[model samples]
Target: MLGTHRHLRGLVGGVAVVAAVAAGAAAHASAAPAPAANGAAAPAATTQKVLFDDTKAETAGNADWIISTSIPDPTKQNASPSKETDWTGALSAWGVALQKTGDYTLDTLGSGNTITYGTGGALDLKNFNTFVLDEPNNQLSAAEKTAVMQFVQNGGGLFLISDHKGSDRDNDGWDSPQVIQDLMSNNGVDNNDPFGVSDDDLDISSGTPTAINDSSDPVLNGSFGKVTSSEIDSGTTWTLHPSDNANAKGLLYTSGSSGNTGVFFATSTYGSGRVAFWGDSSPVDDGTGESGNTLYNGWNTDSNAALALNATAWLGGGSSGGGTGGTTAGSTTGTTSGTTSGTTSGTTSGTTGGTGGCTSGQLLTNPGFESGTSGWTATSGIINTATKEPAHTGSYKAWLDGYGKATTDTASQSVSIPSGCTTANASFWLHVDTAETSTSTAYDTLKVQVLNSSGTVLGTLATFSNLSHNTGYAQHTYSLAAYAGQTVTLKFTGVEDAQDQTSFVVDDTAVNVS
Candidate 1:
């Protein structure tokens, strides 16, 4: 797949579109507009880190996809002339946008730490809030898949990008389609929907694929800009199974030749994390390609640049336009059944239902673990009441990885949200002090998960790490408005490294509904 000259042959609408030829056309001279935030100053990007994966033999070149080399003219043109430096060519623009906005720090994974799951020799998802896999040429190892799935479940963002079928650039048994299919399937996303409908399939589409604007999707009508349309050269399409993943939403679609509509881009929430999938690599391609097959200008065309930024923002726990999981500090509007005539108070116990009934205050189950793990379920590791120094509230709080066992410990509780809850809030105090070394490579972490009835992780509410450098207990809150009328589970997990000890303490966990 290294610079394969195939888009011209795959032109749609019977029109021949070639990247090499397109670059030779009338060139537009322009620079990318300055990064803006709703006509205001763009926020500092220091907090978020975007990790690009080059471990799965992403392409033929080692530095080809590196963001540092991707510098393209903002004006319209064909393939970028800086192919060697801009290996991913226009695709580098995506990273450039994120970097320029100072919204995120872009990094890449090279030959070291091959992506593995539950292992110390691979990429540690804990270091990053989002992961980007663009056009991986090789199949992922079982550990890699596990790492990705669990990472998302534990509240990490993932961007799964793929090209058309037979895009086996390295002649590997896996393409993006097969790899993603397997990844999603193993993670409870079925290749087929219930009632025997095949919803998780991928195929190649011909011609210039029109980008479907789903206004409801934050990636489209996001804070960056309202994405109206985008162009695709030759790309593949993916189908989503919302019936299986309730948080799954199609953001971009293309009507193919055989009465088939292809999903160009889609977003879904898994456990507290967000996942987005795009079907083409050309959208980020510059003019660089292998040998004679160069790509066209995609980063500057349409809303591709904005799309990249918006996607990054959303995945990084921020939104372009108040989309799902926006990190902005404010109360979110959740879907409420009806207006409440009164304020409701809740208690500190009860697993299945709001047993204490509803009151006018926050609710929790032994918020301080003073009553032991009565309402919560401990699955693994040492998750019990601990009488240690620096208790945020009472004499005891929940302690995980307590014994320095080098394990993954978890404790969870189910809560029944009361009716007339127009909005809800879940807050907790966290304390972390660890002896683990290397913030990026270490596995010691504390993850907060949200689960549905079937115990399937719906979203990752939050993730805490010793890397945070918290001097003491800190208060963290998440909007539970998304779960206003439902019964959900809150899972607290502690993942420790094999060597040093990491202590994760939690107390004063509260859920408030109004």
Candidate 2:
């Protein structure tokens, strides 16, 4: 599809609508933005890692809340299970579903293992996008709790599953509720109830989950399906502390309860990561597991299956259980989420990635230039590592056109705005230095534009000249909503005169979508 181009109104606040033709340079201007890498070359791709905890005696008793019987990689039992019975675990359906997606790599923190961060362990908390603790019977050590809290504070997802109070499967004196509460109130990180979601002590024999009127929530209405009412099947409930964590909110509630009390499930954020709380593990139990173990197939009784899968996907990252996963463009992306309040997910400034039809997050890869040109296509020598023109943040910056002759330099990256997103914004910090002393004439110029896949200019977001130079870096942001749902290239081109030299140093770039 052809792209719609917008003209830059001025230095800022430009929002003009216009049509763009198959673009080429003017009679004496630079050529069109170059095509991306030849062959199958694309942005670097990445997979979200999820580590399910079994070390804390998850299988100590009749509670078989495990993705698969096989430790670590679940595929050891079956490469892919068409049905829940294909694997010998109560939560096999959950593991198999994520495995089939191919966008996630699931691992089990088996018995006797310890949760850690920055230790470089293959299964360290830092290595995973999401950490799952389903009905853990053993209380976390002080260090272990610190690791989990620090992980969430530094851009990681946390999934907390709880059981009824005093229901200690391992008879270890601790239960899921106490353990989870301990992690929240007694950790090295912010200890004042970080996520603002606590497991209620009440053991609900059976009840129905009443969905809040939130349709945009990826967990309630996500890829797995819509969550209307879920089965309790011997579960507990959660009480939210919205005052402690302002982002905390209830998604599903118990019958007749409202506000912050009697919350069946809650979600919140801490620092740069996300937190999700579920009252019980029964909804995740697939029922078919090791024989002789009494299990309930609550996974599909109501909206339990959808809630479990969607919550997992949401906790894993991106726009919940939706957004593009494997990409032709090598994946230069990460996942982030918001609660039902849409504090993180539903903002005017969209993020980079999206799944299926839904999309959000920061889109540009190697956005800070700290990774050199790994995800960008730039003219040779454009990605600068030298310190002549300081980067906005890190050591590297994209330098275009410092030659004291008639020359042109360009750099760009291609990104896809999923069809589901309604907003997209491109932003970057630029430092312009020039030897030219023109008070009125615009001798050297740099243009930031959005381009079609075929190298056609879709929109001219901004233009900077020698007159626009400043002592420090200036941030420029443009609305790219017109190019939403399209694979468009963000291009920056600089042109210079034969006498004066002007350099366009750019760093910390991003294309956020929603």
Candidate 3:
């Protein structure tokens, strides 16, 4: 359920208190935080990219998603595209906010991209850091699912905006709810462990949904302040399973059928990436639209605009120096270049026995390579001490060949297995930057192998090649239950062909035994 609040106007605990104050009142209530008093430091802005999805046949490819307009709307319908009517699109206000405060560039994926991967015409997931899929009425193909999953697993942000179960805009066989379910369930994705949550089976047709007062969450408070109210015309909800994923959080909730609770907004983590799911798309619409089409003054009607902006900022790498507005870290509202800083936590520095050298569940020492590769054996390549590319977790990661090199590299770390432990799991983050072809004959590959204490290869855990096409760091998990009772070594072998180059990076090596 959505957690408690301090002084929300329309929500109390888990129940809706009242219809959001009139549109004008909401605007006055949810205004951006005032500028710093007495010339104090202002919140800085984050520069990021957001890609709206249009490949799913949304509104006949018009998508109705764009940034806000600078001009006023006309009395009559203006169907043709023009700068004056940019407000007619659903995401106009959101895009405008990103441009003004967050320094974010927003664009839509055209029909040509096609959402598929590895078919020679597949959309390149590396081009954008965040992907927004709203009101998808088409079923996702296997390739599309794999592409999206891999994209998110590799530190990409995904915003899933769905609608009511049967609110199929197009008369196609698929709907937003069903397609989202397919994406999160094993039945369609063909994996034992899915994304770990699915939408709740409830459609609220009457009252609106109250934003849960979650002050601690960055998404609720980040650029927009607190999210108090959202217009939910007719929307569904989500159900979070903490057993499957420990990071799932319910951001919006309401009374469900039979006096139970329902969650309409939820956030979770898939591998090293972040995900947010909103139940409805109407909250993004701006009143302008063609005649005979349903419209909503959602951006100004409630805290909808602020909610969208906050969600976007959170999805784009959480807080940037914990700053806001367009101010650089040490500069005034307009200047740039003041140095962006981040902290690294939980590094292994000599301790042993648990995951990442922790006292209990930690297992690997110097797993992040922050201590200059003290715990691992390397061949042909070395730890990348320079902070060129961001590490998946800590401050350091092993670079197989420093990109653009045609050479083989190997890195290995040994772990002691507890005799009483019945389950063991090995996981790490890997980044692949390659110039090789992603076809059947791809030669630059990263192979994960398990070796017994006697220097004998037990098995090959997995092989990642250019066919998967991950341009960012993605978490790879392999079960080490087969070596539970014996000490073994996990080795990452990067093989590069003589022609093209591939850089294989490994970081945050961890083994959980219990």
Between the candidate structures 1 and 2, which one is better when assessed by lDDT? 2
Q: What is the per-residue lDDT of model 2 for residues 71-140, given as tens digits with 9 covering 90 to 100?
A: 9888888887777777788888888877776656788999999998656577777566678999889989
Per residue, candidate 1 scores C-alpha lDDT tens digits across 1-514 of 1111111111111111111111211121101112244321234434565678877666554214445432222112323323323333335556555555544555577644466422332234545557888877766665566557545543456888777776676665767667766666553221122111112334554444454534444566566776765666667776654334434555666754222236677766553456778777767765554443445667777777667677766675622111223332211212111111221122544333333344445566666665665677875323343334235655545666634446777878898767655446777766655655442333566777778899887665554554432335545566666576689998888886665666766666788765
Summarize candidate 3's per-residue lDDT along 189-249 as a digit string, tens digits: 2242334468764567744667665454566666566677676777787776643443566
TM-score of 1: 0.56
What TM-score number comes out for model 3?
0.55
TM-score of each: 0.56, 0.57, 0.55
The number of the candidate with the highest lDDT is: 2
Error of 3 at 177 (Å): 0.5
lDDT for each of the candidates? 0.53, 0.66, 0.56
| Alpha-carbon runs more than 4 Å astray in model 2 | 1-46, 318-514
Model 3, position 226, has a per-residue lDDT of: 65
